[model samples]
Target: MGKCIICGKPVDGLICEFHEEDVVFEFEGTSPSQLTPGRYYRGTVDGYADFGVFVDVGDHVTGLLHRSELDRRLESLDWEPGDTVYVQVLDVRDNGNVDLGWSIRQADREFRGSLIDAPDGEYRPGERDAEDESSSADDDSTTADAGPSTNGGDATPDEPAEPAEPAATPTMEIEEPDAPLKRTTVDALDDQVGSIVRLEGEITGVRQTGGPTVFELRDETGTVECAAFEEAGVRAYPSVEVEDVVALEGEVERRYGDLQVETETLEVLADDERETVATRLEEAIEQQARPETVEPLADDEAVAALENELVDAATTIRKAVVEARPVVVRHSATADGYVAGAAIERAVLPLVRDQHTRDDAEYHYFERRPLEGTVYDMDAATGDVTSMLEARDRHGEQLPLVVLVDAGSTVESTDGYDLLEVYDVDRLVIDDSHADEAVVDAVSVAVNPTLAEANGGAVTSTALAANVAAHVNEAVRDDLEHLPAVSYWEEPPAAYVDLATEAGYDETAVTEQREAVALEAYYQSYKDKRELVADLLFGDERDLAAHVSEQFRDKLEAELETARENLETTSIDGVTVATLDTAAFTHRFDFPSANLLLDELHRRERDDGPFVTLGLGEDELHVRTTTPVDVRELGETVADAVPDAGVRVVGGRDGHVEFLVGERDSVREAALDALAETLA
Candidate 1:
């Protein structure tokens, strides 16, 4: 018997079975199932497919390197049909199909040690006699007489053996009781740099880059990035996930002015150890996240009544940043929605930079997605879930915390919320819409005016988000104080107007930022345009905001002029009803979209005496009134008057109604008659 190289335990071979899988292995097996999962192997490119690439691990075993498992796209791969590549055997299916994963290390020498995977398990190259075979020819000129006895005693009868195993694995002793380790907190790591340190903490984040897999470990004191690598793009500790309480042993090293632990060994704590660590982390986080006193941004009774919910929303965002969870802010593609989303983005990005060591942590941890509509429908939630799942599975990223700003309030978003609920992804909705009461209870934190017993008409999403943003960080309150005023299209709230004026933003400047953000929100509706938006809202120079707002005014004014020229007015029951042929007059595809143009025209040219500006289009009839009109009531009126028009209240926030294009004339005539009778 020989001593196991790693644990120094007496065994049949030099290495034990427990540590055998830790080293890289060379494949000598013929069948695909014979190969071990989570082990790297040399492979040759067999061919490429539209979805993925096929690689031959050995002569008879071929595995598929799925495109989803790649760090880059399949088209970017430079490998030809015959090029050799290194891959990790992710799984060996029961049907003898091998699923291969990408490896950054192209050479075997980059790994710790080499072994051969056999039918039993894994072992050294020459350990199994049946697998190791060599022969000497006449031209080889081997000495018949033994010079130094090169063959070991384990050699076969017909063949000579190689030398005894060399010392490759480290010498370690396994005691009856585990050895006690000297542990230190993350805050004290700076003093232990370049020295071996053991840390007990929770894994806040796990990210697999092209090189090492970085685990953001957090203790009560602070957080540090621990990088563990078996091979590139391969999970170093596949069993360890985010939120796991682990005890990691490594040497603390500083890279690029940041402290990183070069992990040598990591173990997930269990039972007592896990409970102790988790309890300590929870206590610390609770104290840090909850402020002793939450000071409301404004002295309004309505805002004060929502103190608990606002604090909860801020705490959720702060905790998400501290834990390295990606924060996805989904908002409507409008001035108020973008402002609300940008307020949270401004607060969270600074916290993200402070919490994580990654330079692009803001981009990776926070995403502001401008939704096409004001509802978090299933389509939007499905897309978000798919992208986040891909990021988690392929890149080892933590599942994100979705922050619904000005969305996820109505009953229509319930299905979308349920989809995210299936993944157990934490969601927080900060809106001022007329939300279904069920939606308020469905989310982790819902901060809506309707839920707070406040009139939803007076509270805009930007106003609510700005209040929450102040409590999220409190440092960016001045930067975001002007945002609430920018969300108002008509008469501004006195409090928000005063707040903006105090923060050096006059009515014109607030209008400029509002119009600038609205115009920019249309382009790249998919992306948040972080830098451009930051410049427009929080930039030092007002010139950029002025320039963009000039474009906004130019386009909106041109559309308004066209609408005025095409205005078709009629007196019905002494009510001045103005109608605009939206299809022929407005620039359908250009800036100041249909809704914006109609809002502006209705704001500008509507006469008194219960004015109604009806924007008549092919498929939609958008209504704007000088007085508050219950949309559902008007929809019922129009539908009763014109049964074939199929008029429906499609938009709740703006009193928007829709009708069939085939019944446009009937719908318009009935709408005019309904307005005349109601006014009379």
Candidate 2:
């Protein structure tokens, strides 16, 4: 055997058939020559690193380039594999494995590389491949091929297993049948609310927070809760997904907290049959939409950015949470309006827990502007401050000034104005012990002094340190001091106040008010606040936070707009703007809608695990759990549901879901229904 191809050895009898082939494409190292660097080549991208793309050209030989090798000017381009690109050979020292090269796509147009040269080695046959096949064939014939043996490959005594049940007729349609109650179409059934009629729908949600998987299963009519044990729940649909549409048979049992439509059975549709169901649902939703029109609110890129911004906003709100603090409670009469008296939208600055009532404030006001001789009365039992006109007598109109103060407390204007003397006005003896301790704690500082017409009727000598009015007319200034335009200090945030009192904290300590974010953490992490907000807002996906953000913005914008407009007309003379610095109500805005959507999506499928949100476009919407929610199907579904509705479709971020028109509610509904059908 002068020329035996297998093993490259001369042999005669029982020759191995491998190690022989017409051509052998072998790679040796990380060089260009080792690769089939043509316009198009096949290989695995084994590893990806921050530095470059690691390609398994073959034979465990990986060539690392600044992914730029695939397309040299990579920094200016977006490239992803399996994308087409050009390459050329440079060096391959170790046989044909080690390779180095440049991108043909990145090379100059004038530099036309030559074609690959064929090797000079003569034709040869290989026996290794055939031997491998033979061995593999032998292995395939073993019992293990069926799967791993249960008893160490040893067969146990065969036990008589029960015969499997016969398959039911394929076209099993779970339909709603008409009864004596009413023969109404589901569209018509809604009007017959109290009627006991059959309604067929697939399960949409299964929230088993504590025990069994309890979820709402709905169709054209409505949703109902269905519960099952752990075993039966898992066994019902081994392949059940979030968007699987399933038919259920149940009865309506509506009662607070127990409102549910019971289901006796849950049947899954076959894969081939689901397309038709999804298609039908899609058609229905489209039917409800404005079929021939849609306007893009924002592109994919814009929406992504908006989503990131939302998360940051939410985080900022969270950071603003603060512990409840001391506040004064006083009752005052609601003045006759027309004056649209004392309007301050920021009155309820921070929200306390619902278990407790919101902070209430009271301010005494003179009906007409005071002409310097205005006297007020202080009720001893109530600590109520009132003017002489409200003294309950006309001839004996002498007024008693109510003095309320906590000792050693200080109150001064932002301009460094002290008004301790003003709180020292004479008390005309309304009650024997009118100045009580309860009154002192509530009023931080008070000024009740007998002027005795002192030296030209001037005020002097402060009674307390904080009471600037007593010494220098410390009236704590009126609401007018901090009006539409007030000094920054006049209304500093609680956090900023801490900064103000701190040794070296001031406007210079933090960024400018306009440039600053409410959250210190975000500011600390992102050096550039504007860039951080823009980057997070413009280049991200809409997640769960985005949805909440949308709700928050929608609500907040409405509230703010209304308040701002109303404030323009209403005059609030006594509202202390600086008092709002300590208020924070972030937690009150919690809406479980986002979590609920995610939970619902998860219950429909086992793998979905928990709720996860992704921003598809500018909106943070639930992923369409249902399959085949293409644009066409979406239009159809909208059309069917609301015949002439102006519809806009958006791809889902989390699941394979499709949303309806521009209207948030309809889109949510269509997507949820589609999910029901998909994971039915």
Candidate 3:
């Protein structure tokens, strides 16, 4: 008999049956019945299909490799007809159909031994001389529990090692039983610095720096960084990736004030061992990291109904942090949007720091993106998918949890949410906007005032987000309590104002922070500007908020002064209607975006006898008024009066309406006439 390559146990051939499926074999059989189920075989690519690829395992036997069985995209495969490839026979149906699974090993040398299918339902060496009289049928399962061995014999009991050649799967080196070293948790590494330690964990992130490949590993207790230096910029352990369960041998060392492991050896665990470790880690995390019930931020009737969803949103975010998945926050580009997004960022960064040992964990784990408009569209979703998929492929990072704040409440966002659902990425929407009923179905969690039967007008995205943020990380409640006040453009909610006052932010400071964030939000629009935003909103140095606020006031005042000079007024059915040619009077490209300028202009004009500010641009008209105007009603009236205008209430909740300027003069005249008729 030949000995099993692993464990040095005597078997029928070079490898035992327990490791039969572990190695790639060349099948000489000609029929599906002759194929051994679960054994990987060298196959030839026969053809491709939309749903799968056909591979010829033998002259007459063919198997289907379904796209679902592929590790990556089917289109990514470079195989052509007749190309030699490797696939596993997952099953052979009684009808002579074979199902195939992708095999990671492509080279013949990666596995030990070659087995031939025998008509007697046994596996034997292709060369008869390789088998001896000592071989027996019971050898298959007899040595299944054996540790790794080599060609000559097993290594010395004191220093167990892997075979010189690559095995079907890399496994941990069997340590000497007498020289036992217990596995250490990451949280205990602080005390174990400068000492050799063994650790079992999953690789949460893998990054190749100039000198070392840094693997961010997380156990049930905590997370730590392990560095494996093979050569400068060269990838060490090409088979390992994020989410891989591993048994690592290393020395805990201090690097630049942080604890890191200098890896001596790292091994990816086998399937069964990996599952056991993963299940244990998951159970431990679930026990310790489960979110607790959050006390309501306020007992307002509007907030009461949403208490459950608020808790759920916070819970989802907390779970993502514990699971090492990045949280992506998408918000509108307005002051309200930025403040809401910033509040979530504030809550999440601290949790990331507490959970991870990496100093830059906050940046790596949390990101905030500002959207162009109130709708989450396909363009934005496509960009997010592209970037995140690249992160998955390059670093093996888990898919991110996409949180939409101040947006994603309408049917317009359905397509975007659908795209995300295809990848099974979790989504959360926190907004106070008027929502379509279908929106709740599109996201994992929908925390909206409208859905909870609360008055949407009584809520703002900042209020919803700030409350969720507070519950997400209670330590940042003091920092986030002032955010809602900064989001209001007109009447700040009394509750938010009272809360801000208690937090020590007076009226002026709130205004300054609001203006500063709005100004900064306009510049980048895309980037989160994590540090810059933190400084502007929460910093005391350089009077950053004060400085940006001053700039905001100057620009806004100058624009308002110029706008008032050019404003023309008329009485329309008892309502004093104000009109400004935004295309002519306003600096469309300068400080204070058209939306902000128009909001302020409308606010200022409303003091005089129920006024309305109609800022007419080249192809669009934005309507804002102090007089209570049913925007949807007025839009329908205008559309009826001026059929060519195509007017509609685009922002129903904000009392904002839009219409095409196709017939600009006609549209304006019709809008004025419609308002006059309504008021009359």
Candidate 4:
């Protein structure tokens, strides 16, 4: 019988059945049948195949470590042929096939102790020599009892031999005290793997996984994950949370090619030590977050006019990343909005990856959400509050910095911005619309050309965002050169068109990309679709854009044909007014939404003369005009004409109004009359 290494209890082998999984085993047998299932073993990388890798267990046995069993991507594995690795033997088939699974620990010392699995039995490495010596001692005792004594005296059976002197009990020697543990920084942990280290830093994030509690620790140099476990699926150090200064001792380990710290002891720092770490982190973040300069992508006076505001906005975003705060971007569900949001996404993702140590920091630190319209209403604000609160309670995350791009600039968004203010969440707005003066005080930073007395009507939100994105990270400036042109449905400015042309995107390509993004935005309007959008705009896959654009063209043409066939035209006060009952003519729940179809139909019918297109839905009215129209003012006019109709504008700059379904005819007639007087 052997003893369990952990509990010190005698068992059938080196470990009890309950603790078998804790010990690692070495295979000494020559055949696959000698492998024990559900136990970890040391193996060598024999070779790799498309589906899995082949690991050699012993001299004559091999195991297949399938890709499905890997916790990470198979291609991410750095193991080469003949390199040592650790894997669990999941099964040994009747036909001599060995199946292996992934093991979290790769080092031998990570296990309690190793036992050799020989052809005959399992034993520790030096147990055989100890057993032989024990047998020899027993034989010597037997010989001495049966033969005459060494003193040369005959002893009778009744006579007892002289008692042997009791062997002296061994005394433990006291050694000198151990040296104090040296402090190591996160950046230097790579060179100290498999060794104990002490670190002092501030905890930026804390997450609970199935078996461990992972705390994201950030020092002056970088960030790293430190895992502590109290038990299976239980929280460790429940008092620790984000933004707390801590001193930790752990073994530096490599898990799935990423450096991790297996925490042994973690303590919160107080007084001077805590202040020291916090001050160091704050100083580093401040110095790294501020951009040295703010430069526009193109030579545009409109963009250059807002250079100071752009620098402030860029500084806020950069500082959020360095401070480990999430950036939540909210944009309108339109072509321009998507382009604006994607440009910022492209710039911020690289900064997130560079500032954090985890591979998934980009996803955690940056998020993009599409708003239904140009207004950030209370519904969106409520949803954002709920999600942010949940994240804070569950993961100990700090409140995110909400960024409004191409949206949330008018008075309609004031209530939403007010709700966010109650939580003290930071907000930044980058828009080109006629922003309400009150909005300037609601957000942290407002970057709008109207506030600077620039030509806001001619500037698209994409232009401002692309310029700000360039300032955020100058390295991605070339990647955003063509974005401004994609936001314009009509003829873009010559400066932007020339910029896109110089960036290898012709007019046709820009149009196709714009159409494609608009079509995708209508579906899953709330989702960001970060990867798909990135591929369509920045990836090398040109065919993907063409394919999606073709679908967009087909859908729009179909909707436009139906809309034109049912169109009604009238001239009031020398202004042409075209109307369509979109509820009866267009597909309500599919592609080519009422707004998009109306825009296309009006584009086809409008000439140099003043034209207005009204797409009447069940309870809403969408207006598209050749002349600038204030839907809010139009709503007030209609409300006066039809007092019972609940006339209110939903989308501010996009020109959307809502009324009672029963008063649709009254609202339509009143809206046309109001448009005629305004346009005349």
Number of the top lDDT candidate = 4
Segments in model 3 whose C-alpha atoms lie over 4 Å from true places: 1-176, 208-212, 229-236, 264-275, 287-290, 455-457, 607-610, 627-661, 670-680
What RMSD does each model have against the real structure?
A: 13.4, 33.4, 18.6, 11.0
Model 2 TM-score is 0.19
Stretches of candidate 4 off by over 4 Å are: 1-183
* TM-score of every candidate relative to the true structure: 0.72, 0.19, 0.68, 0.76
Ten consecutive residues with minimal summed lDDT in candidate 2? Answer: 331-340
- Looking at candidate 2, what is the lDDT of residue 641? 72
Candidate 2, residues 12-73: lDDT per residue as tens digits?
Answer: 42222343212123333333553443322223333232234434444334444444355444
Q: What is the clash count for each candidate, in the order shown?
A: 0, 95, 0, 0
Q: How well is each residue in 99-179 modelled by candidate 4, as lDDT tens digits?
A: 899999999999887888778877887887799999999999998878777335666657877766788999999999989
Would you list the C-alpha lDDT of every candidate in the order shown?
0.79, 0.29, 0.80, 0.86
Question: Cα deviation in Å at residue 249, candidate 3?
Answer: 3.2
lDDT of 1 by residue, 413-513 (tens): 78888999999999999887666788876799999877878742477888889889988887888898888889998787787789899999999999999
lDDT of 3 by residue, 496-579 (tens): 788888988888889889999889888868777778888988887638899988998898899999999999888877888889
Q: How close is candidate 1 to the true structure, as a TM-score?
A: 0.72
Candidate no. 3 TM-score: 0.68
**How many residue-pair clashes does candidate 1 contain?**
0
- How many angstroms is residue 543 displaced in model 4 relative to the true structure, after the best TM-score fit? 1.3
lDDT of 2: 0.29
The better candidate by lDDT, 1 or 4, is 4
Superior by lDDT: candidate 2 or candidate 4: 4
